[model samples]
Target: MKHLTRLATAALMTTSLATFAQAGGHANWTSVADQSSIAFGSIKKDTVGEVHHFEDVIGTVSEAGELAVSIQLGSVETYIDIRNERMIEHVFRAADAKATLAGEVDMEELDALGVGETTLTDFEGVLSLGGLEADIEAELLVARLSEDRVLVTTANMIMLSTADLGIDAGIDTLMKLAKLPGITRVTPVTVRMVFEK
Candidate 1:
C-alpha cells in the first residue's frame, strides 16, 4: 500500500510539471526565418516594374499577441548589386536607420483559433523606416498550423508611399542616380511569416 501511494504521488508530480511547461511555452513565439519572406514591387519610368526582397528579416510574437518584425535594410536584394547599393545608400539610408513594423492583436482571438482553422482579418500597425513612422493597415490570412505553430500571410499587397514616410527626397535621389525619367512614389509590399512557440 505504501509503494502504491508513492507511485501515485510521483505520477501526479510529473503531470503537474508537464502542464506547467506547456503553459509557459504558449506565452512566447519566435519567427521561423526559413519559412518566411518579405518582398516588394517597385515601378520606375511608369512602366518598368521590379520585384525586390529583403534577405534578412526577423520577427517575434509575444504572449500578449504583440507582433514585431525587423528588417535589415542592407539586405535589400534587387538582383543587381549596384542597384542594391544605391537603394541602401540613397533610399533606405541603411547606414543610419533600421526598419521595423509592429502591431498588437487580441490574444483571445488567437487563443480561440482551433487546430487547422484559418481566419482572414485586418491588422493595423506602424511601419517605421528612414526615421519616419506611418500607420498602416494590412489584410492578413492567419492559420493555426498546430498547437505550437501559426502561419500569417498578407492577403493583399500593402501600399506604401514615399511621401507618407518622408522618403520623397530619397526617391528623388534614387531617380537621379539611376538616370530614370520617373519612379513611382507608391510601392507594394507583401509578407509571409511563421511563428513557433
Candidate 2:
C-alpha cells in the first residue's frame, strides 16, 4: 500500500508539471513591432485636441499570466519637430527615458481562446510613467487573429490624470511656454497591441 501511494504521488506531480508547461507555452507571445501600436490624446487650450503616437513600443505576454510593456518616452511623435523636442525636455524630462506597464492576466482564459474567437474582458494594470506609477483599468477586447497571432485592443478609453503620473508640472510648463490659455489635465489613451508566438 505504501508503494502504491508513492506511485500515485509521482503521477500527480507529473500531471501538474505537464499542465503548467502547457499553460506557459500557450501564453508566451512577443509583440510584433510593425503591427503593434499605442496611442494617447491630449487637449490644449480647452478645445484643441490632438492624438500622439508612440513610435517605439514593445511588449510580451509571459508564462503564469504576466504581461509587460515598455515604451521609449523619447519616441513620441507629436507631428511638430520643436514640440517633440520640447515635450522630451519638459514633459518626459529625460533624453533616455522609458515608461513601463505591467498587468496580470488569466493564463487559463487566454489559453482557452481559439482562433477567430474574441472576448471582452476587464483589465487592470500598473502604468509607470514620469517616475511614478498609477493603477489603470480598462475594458479590453482580445481576439485570436491566427494560430500564431493574438490581438488586444482597448474597448474603452483609459483616462489618466497627469498629476497622478507626476507629469503635471511639465505640462504646466508647456502651457506657459506655448502661451496656451489652458490644457486639460486628464488625457485619454488607447492601445492596439498585436503579439505572435
User: lDDT by residue for model 1 over 1-197, one digit each (tens)?
Assistant: 11111111111221111221122346667667788667677777888877777766666666555666666666767899888787777767664345666766655444566768877766666666656677766666777777877677667766666677676777788788879899777677766666676
lDDT of 2 at 58: 69
> Of the candidates shown, which would achieve the greatest TM-score relative to the real structure?
2
Give per-residue lDDT, candidate 2, residue 2. Answer: 12
What TM-score do all the candidates reach, one by one?
0.83, 0.84
State the lDDT of candidate 2 residue by residue for 111-183, as single tens digits: 6768788777666667666556767666667777777777777676666666676776787788788898887
Runs of candidate 1 with Cα error greater than 4 angstroms are 1-25
Model 1 error, position 24 (Å): 12
Quantify all predictions' global Cα lDDT against the true fold: 0.60, 0.61
In model 2, the runs with Cα more than 4 Å from the true position are 1-27
RMSD of model 1 against the true structure? 15.5
